[model samples]
Target chain A: MAHSTTLEPTATPATYTDAPRTGTWDGGNEPFKASYGKLMMWFFLLSDAFTFGAFLTAYGMIRHKHGVFTGTAKQFYFSTAHWPIPEKVFNAFPGLHGDLPLAFVALMTMILIFSSVTMVLAVEAGHRMDKADVQKWLLWTILFGSMFLSSQAWEWSHFIGGHEEGTRMADGTLMFGANLAMNQYGPPLFGDLFFFITGFHGTHVFSGVCLLVWCFIATTNGTFEKRGHYEMVEKIGLYWHFVDLVWVFVFTFFYLV
Target chain B: MSAHAAEAEHAYVPGEIAKPNTAWIWKTFWVLVAITALEFVIAFTLTSPDWRTFRNSIFIVLTILKAFFIVGEFMHLKHEVKSLIWTVLVPTSLLIWLVVALVTEGSFIGEVLSHMFT
Candidate 1:
């Protein structure tokens, strides 16, 4: 509701005390010494961490429920009775044949990390008010991020396409690739969790890329220059780093563990 | 505008941005890469079933180590005020409890499923 009293402009815009607060809890100052936007970004990231944590924890539970596979890698086969080894499922690589194990995913991880580095570089450039450097680093970050997404797309396709032979289900029908309902992998839940968790992370990456583009545009437009601060770059840098951090965990739990 | 409103709008002046540390950023990147490489090596080498627990634990520890660098250096959390650091980290520690409780319950259900279906 609009308040007429508050909305009306006063003759003198009353100035507040510029004196330093005596205590951290004194209501007038930023106790954390961070801008409101930065603090909120941290909080948002914290909340997002919990969301991913819940997903991974649920993944761990479902994985534990399915039980670990005891057979050697070579001896392992697609079956609903036992959980499939991650390496076995994710072995395919682009333009290569045979089992490459965790190679492709590792490449994806590196791409994301590199992008994160570029993002931080961009943020650093922003702090110096170097518009050229900011645009340069942001471009690199966006490039690397797009590379990661493309790699993920390839991985997902390879996963969904399955091998030509395919695995025979209990009912004698041959199943190819993976979907929410059934997969040639092990249990249906395996395919389901893989898609959901990684898909969620992928969505975050996609959005992060879009944000980087926006930051790049703003940098070119001299928006932050006019504002006398590049805090916007820092905020988006936080988000980009958060995405990379989530991938580190995902790499471990989803693939390695 | 009223004094309260004026104060509200102008009270929060942001502090100066910290100086950039390019060297630290590169060092952190190398550290992350090294840790990830180690993970891959372990995954490829430790294939036996008996080593599963040990391997998983190592992976978890290494992942946490990587997380420290990413959050601390890349996200610049380590440079923030102490209160901000605690606020971000304290709430995250609850995930440990969540993991323990849910995972324990999961194992029990898993045992039931294995018995029922097999």
Candidate 2:
């Protein structure tokens, strides 16, 4: 429709009807209609982008309305008025913990960042048609992705475990939502939003790990190598990079903002 | 019938780097990293009631810049013809606009809530 209904053929596209439906987005054409995989991947990314945008926007709206102080956020467990700050809450250590700063989450962030790097490396390996390199980088990317997922698991546990000073409702009454408001560390909305946004993202990461693992497994068994190129790597790379990109926004909005 | 079905109409080369310029990749990476760092620094250093507005404006600009490089270089949005570029950017821009409108409505509710309940 785009070409037929339109007058000019701006870019030349090559058709490979014989190729397997291996991707929704990946390398198909150097400049024309990308492979079905890459196209689909972009569609997925676009939908995902909207989902994330919606969440962050809602979070912002809530923050603007309820960001003010109802009372001195008091720490119930620690016996202090300093309730759990977002940075402080996420920063603490697990075992040898002593008022650390963004320890676990920071580690998780690094893991994700490394995974992003590994993903690019894998894509590069794909470009070279180096199966060994593709396998190596992709495996590293998968492992790091798994590690990030685990770290997120730990973060969730800590959040659900409940903090000292919890959430204060609109009535100025402090109530526990089963560690609902005053979680194991700080405010309830912190956990509420943390779980809602990051949890959803964590699900995506988990799924991505599964996808990466599948791709890596295929790499070992000589799938992409058999096909004679690394478009697979780039296809998944796009998704991986998109995930990393989304996290940057989530971190900025939920943490720093 | 689908645009994709006209695949025979367009020639394709798989995994071929459009620019074939490694130099641009490295240069773009450095520029992107530098801009990201600057964004972080400005986010931390600024302090004003207009801080929210200023920070938001800067963050958005930085985000758009970063997105451009990623799309242009990494995702190869630039390699495609101008029509393709316009097709993608127009839709994505419209999506962002939709989100912005929804969020503004949410903020309005927040304002009303603050007045009634606060």
Candidate 3:
């Protein structure tokens, strides 16, 4: 009767006869203090991280099995005998010709990072319930996400099209472009990993863009305004940031390292 | 249900909602940009075969550093409850074992392949 008298409605209802309710884990309060949707987003991101980690790990193993080309940067050239240097392979920039290694990918990295900044700003505006600011920042985030996707498209086309002089295959015929079958870049595995990893990452960016568009529309429609909370923007913002986080690793392992 | 009780049912407790901090956001943006630029500089200058291992180590270290900021600040994971932070981070730490095992095994395979191919 003493415990029953002290029982608060906010606490989980007493079920056991003897056990005292600790209140934290009594099933009434959220232990993490996060809404279900937000916590689910974090878990989803965690699983997505493993998916990427597995791909990159496999790539590293295969790359190690095929020794890298250790010659000087000037001496480096595409060959089937060894792993090609990433800089030499990814050297092209749209509109600009010649060997400016990593410049274009660097530009893409900047674009992704900038978009992430905009996404957080949108979330911040949402916190204040500033619908207009949320829409504006969300628009910038979408624009940057699209720019990043376009940059990737150009990079992929360049990769698939190959260079002026293609690598000579084992059959003594010159092979231009890259496919799952072969590549001008080095081992066939090189092209395969490049396509799979970056393509998977690109798909994520595309989806993030689509989600942002939906969030933008919802803001325009004053849906969050009616709900009196902008948690939807926060949820999408988590996904957008996770995409950017994946890009950081992709940029490192695929390009820099 | 009475209005007061209904409101109480859904209310966020103190510190549940973070304050809007624009300045901190910009500061994090600059930090991310600076780290990325540094990575580019190292990539270009440290191109010699001799520095390959050392340079790669630096890149990985910097990458993890950047990851901290992106996940902690941008994702707002740092501001979340302690249990939530650990739930996300503790499981991710398992990736270290996967990277080590596979890469070491890959080198051994590389040794075997070299003999066969040659």
TM-score, prediction 1: 0.89
lDDT of 3 by residue, A120-226 (tens): 99987777677778999999999999999999999999999998899888899999989999999899999999999999999999999999999999999999978
Model 1 ranges with Cα > 4 A deviation = A1-8, A11-26, B1-21
- The weakest ten consecutive residues by lDDT in model 3 chain A span A9-18
Task: Write the candidate numbers in order of decreasing TM-score.
Answer: 1, 3, 2
Give the CA lDDT, 0 to 100, for residue B64 in model 1. Answer: 99
Model 1 C-alpha lDDT per residue in residues B5-114, reported as the tens digit of each score = 12212322344333455777788899999999999899989988889899999999999999999998888787777899999999999999999888889899988876
Taking all chains together, each candidate's TM-score versus the true structure is 0.89, 0.71, 0.89
Give the winner by DockQ: 1 or 2: 1
Task: Name the candidate, 2 or 3, with the larger DockQ value.
Answer: 3
lDDT of 1 at A34: 84
lDDT digits (tens) for residues A105-131 of candidate 1: 988998999999999889877776778
Candidate 3 lDDT, B28-83, residue by residue in tens: 99999999999999998988999999999999999999999999888888777789
Indicate the DockQ of the complex predicted as candidate 1: 0.44
Q: DockQ, in order, for the candidates?
A: 0.44, 0.16, 0.46
Worst 10 residues of 2 chain A by lDDT: A72-81
TM-score of chain B of each: 0.79, 0.73, 0.80
lDDT of 1 at A129: 72
